[model samples]
Target chain A: MKCRKLKDSLSAYISEELSERQMSRMSRHLATCSACAGELASFKRLYERIDAVPQVLPSDDFEERFWRKVKDADAGSSSVKALPLFDWTLGFKWGVSVAVAVVVMVGAYFYLHTSYGDKARGKSEIAEMADIDRYLEFYKNYEVIKKMDFLIKLEKDKSLGDNNLPENRTL
Target chain B: MRYDRDTQLMLAFKRGDKKSFDILFKRYSVLLINYIYRFLGSRHKAEELAQEVLLKIYLAKDTYRPKAKFSTWVYRIATNACLNELRRHEYHHHSVSLDASGEENPVNRKVWMDDQAFTPEQSMEKRGFEEAFKEALKTLPERQKAAFLLNRFQNASYSEVAGALSCSVASVKSLIHRATVGLKDKLKDYII
Candidate 1:
């Protein structure tokens, strides 16, 4: 196998994850290849150095501190449970506030909607009434309005008659 | 037998046996501390986080189910705790001042180098390597770091790591491989 392929298999080989056939092939390659063998040794050494890093231990009173935390947590949880009424009241207050806000919003929406609808209807009614009044006023002067054209023709004829006079005539 | 013991102890703890809970704590506290230390690179933070993990285990006893090994569950919790702690701003901002003089200073805390009997030169070399390794470890992606640490430090099998990481075994292998490559590349200068 080429060194590149052998290098890819090096980690699995070092970790002992390679299959027997692959492992044997890798072993053979490493035997013949000095560079691959050196790489493997370096990997092994790195692993050893990593393994050699010392483990840090907890202090002697780790248990004591842990149990104290447990006790405190236990006490805190119990004290929280002790205020059942307060918890319920808090929930109740939030519910009531949300309900009140929702109700106010809904009521305001309906009120505004109804008022707007009423105002729109009232405006249309007033417009209709105004149209009726206008029509009535026109009808009230219907005869006079109907004679206006004749009156205008008579005035035109009179003016024509006046114009026929020499002083009023355009040459 | 080892597998069953932890599960059994957890079951007993769930059944209100306080002593069983104590036994579980005593058994895993050091391991959890060490595991978290690898992630946080701070012994103080690791101990604090380990305490939190134990507290979580204690409080969550009622929710315990025997679906998997108890160690896997513990590790899952510890891993999550470490990740959460890493996410905090304090974790990124905090530094260990070696010359700092205070009880609260992480530098004053006991470290692995303190307990080892080494020549001064050897100790300095080990400390240097450890610091370099930690820096390289910090550069790894979270999942890769978790997989590598669980597989290498915790001695968890790839399958166990997968279970702890909530990923498939294939993904765990990929994560560990990638982490190893990354660490190797970063620590190349230090490695002989």
Candidate 2:
């Protein structure tokens, strides 16, 4: 491998992540190339320095402060939920009020219509009964008038001739 | 069985056992803080970010499934939190000096000398090298930095790094390789 190619693979070589064939080629290149070998050594030293950085610990009150923050967040969220609940209650109240007003208007319309219909029906029935009574009175007067007409016809016949009126004195 | 303890502890916490959460917090707090410190390069910010991450884990307990390893799940959450923090600040401009003279800075207390027994001059040189290494790390792109940190510092395999990063293993390898090349270029002064 050329020095450029070998240098490109240096990270993988140092990390031990290369395939066996590539590792063998890189090893051969490094054996013959003093500059690449020096580069690999430097990478190793750098890795060591990176690993040697110290671990820093937090303050004594870290846990206490963290829990306090969590509690504050929970409180804030609950208050946010309360605002929506209030809006929902207000909406429900308005909806119910509008429904009651609509129902009352419909009921009043039906009640007025039914009362007018009942008054018109009662007037028509009174007119029909008066007509029936007037017809019955006219029928009774006609029967008396017909009997008078028969008696007048019998008197005229007796004045004309007694012989023409024989054996019919009951007429 | 290796991860059963943490898994059970997480499951218990999911079931509303608050004390189990405390135990989980104690176990991973320092580790997560240090990991975030590496990403942000500031102890104070790292601790704050770590607390946020733990709080997220606590709040999202119901979403936790024991299918994957507990450490992997926690690291995934921590990784996302650190990335978000980094993006929010447009990259932490406050550089933490490894050689800052203060008794409180633990990084300054633990020197990174190559030899176990070093003279004062070697310790000072190692400190300079560590500072340069940190600077080089800061220059890397976020994903590459995450890949390198998880692979090298956290001792995660390429596949595990992929899982935490939500990327393929091949992508992680490419990222770490590019990061290594970048670091080698930046720290050429110390190395060669």
Residue-wise lDDT of candidate 2 within B1-192, one digit each (tens)? 455687889889999998999998998898888788777677798889888888888887888877676777778888778766764664533322212223234432222222234332453467686666665666666667777887887777787787887777777778787788777776666655
lDDT of each: 0.76, 0.73
> Which ranges of candidate 1 are over 4 A from the true structure?
A1-6, A18-29, A81-171, B1-3, B90-127
Native interface contact recovery, model 1: 0.65
Model 1 C-alpha lDDT per residue in residues B73-96, reported as the tens digit of each score? 899888888766765544443432
Q: Taking the tens digit of each residue's C-alpha lDDT, what string does model 2 give over A82-150?
A: 787567666798889999999988877755576544454566567668888988888777866766766
In DockQ, how does model 1 score against the reference complex? 0.39
Residue B92, candidate 1: C-alpha displacement in angstroms: 6.7
